[model samples]
Target: MATTNLNIRTDKTIKEQADQIYSELGLSMTAAINMFLRATIRTNGIPFSLTLNEPNQTTIEAIEEGRRIARDPNVKGYHSIDELKAALDV
Candidate 1:
């Protein structure tokens, strides 16, 4: 198989970070780029989700807190709307 050079311009910091990460993963930048290209072709798309609906940090923290509360045995749980309302004095 024949190979050719591909040149791209990117932010210096981003390139540095990518280089470190690829190095840690035992891949060259060329190999990582090849993998990404192959996956993109195989999927007929970007090979990952691209979305604008991501939650903010506050929302993420709130979700984690809610999960923690649900799992904590010491936290009070109400059986129904009436019970929850009574507890909240609503």
Candidate 2:
């Protein structure tokens, strides 16, 4: 099989970091790229997940509020599920 050269433009810092990682894995950059290309063709799409894992604004607000409540000494702390149920009068 004949292989052709592929050229791409990327940040110098990113290339350096990737080079270090590929070296650590005992692969050259070319081999790493070929692995990624083969995986993309086999999968018929991008090789891996490309989604945002960040929480939405509402979730961020709730997490912040929970942290504030945790630091507030006046907020009652429950030692067990029974105590929590009793606090809710359930």
Candidate 3:
């Protein structure tokens, strides 16, 4: 079988954390990545469903408000992805 080299850039912290996790799972990082790539190719995308939790009335209202605020043309200085994610406490 032929082998190819692949390079991906990620934050150092994330890479370290992933390495630790894969080690604990008794897998190498290369093996984990290869598994993910094979699954993606087989399904033409990610192999799992991702669904958000059902929002209660208050959560729904907050989401609607956030959408309204985001839609405002005058709104300025949108938060960075990480900042928004932090704000959502996710």
Candidate 4:
């Protein structure tokens, strides 16, 4: 099979991490990329599912509220599980 070079831009850290993973799997970067390309061609598209794993608006609002409470000095903090359980009356 005739092959050509393929250049792609990715973060340095991401490349380093991928390199480690490929090394552990007994593959080079080129081999890993070729496998991905072949899989893509076989599937007639991307070989893996791509979707947003984002939190919903209500969850986002709750996370922000929790952060605000954490930053507020007036908010009560329980130091132990027993204390938390007592506060919750459980």
Candidate 1 has which clashing residue pairs, if any?
none
Query: What lDDT does model 2 reach?
Result: 0.96
Q: How close is candidate 2 to the true structure, as a TM-score?
A: 0.64
Question: Per model, how many backbone clashes are there?
Answer: 0, 0, 0, 0
lDDT by residue (20-64, candidate 4, tens digit) is 999999999999999999999999999998879988899999999
**What is candidate 1's lDDT per residue for 34-68, written digit by digit as tens?**
99999999999998999899898999999999999
TM-scores, all candidates, are: 0.60, 0.64, 0.54, 0.61
Instruction: Please identify model 3 stretches exceeding 4 Å from their true place.
Output: 49-90
Candidate ordering by TM-score (highest first) = 2, 4, 1, 3
Off by over 4 Å in 4: 54-82, 85-90
lDDT of each: 0.97, 0.96, 0.90, 0.97
Question: Which has the greatest TM-score?
Answer: 2
Candidate 3, residue 37: CA error in Å?
A: 0.2
Candidate 2 lDDT over residue span 18-45, tens digit each: 9999999999999999999999999999
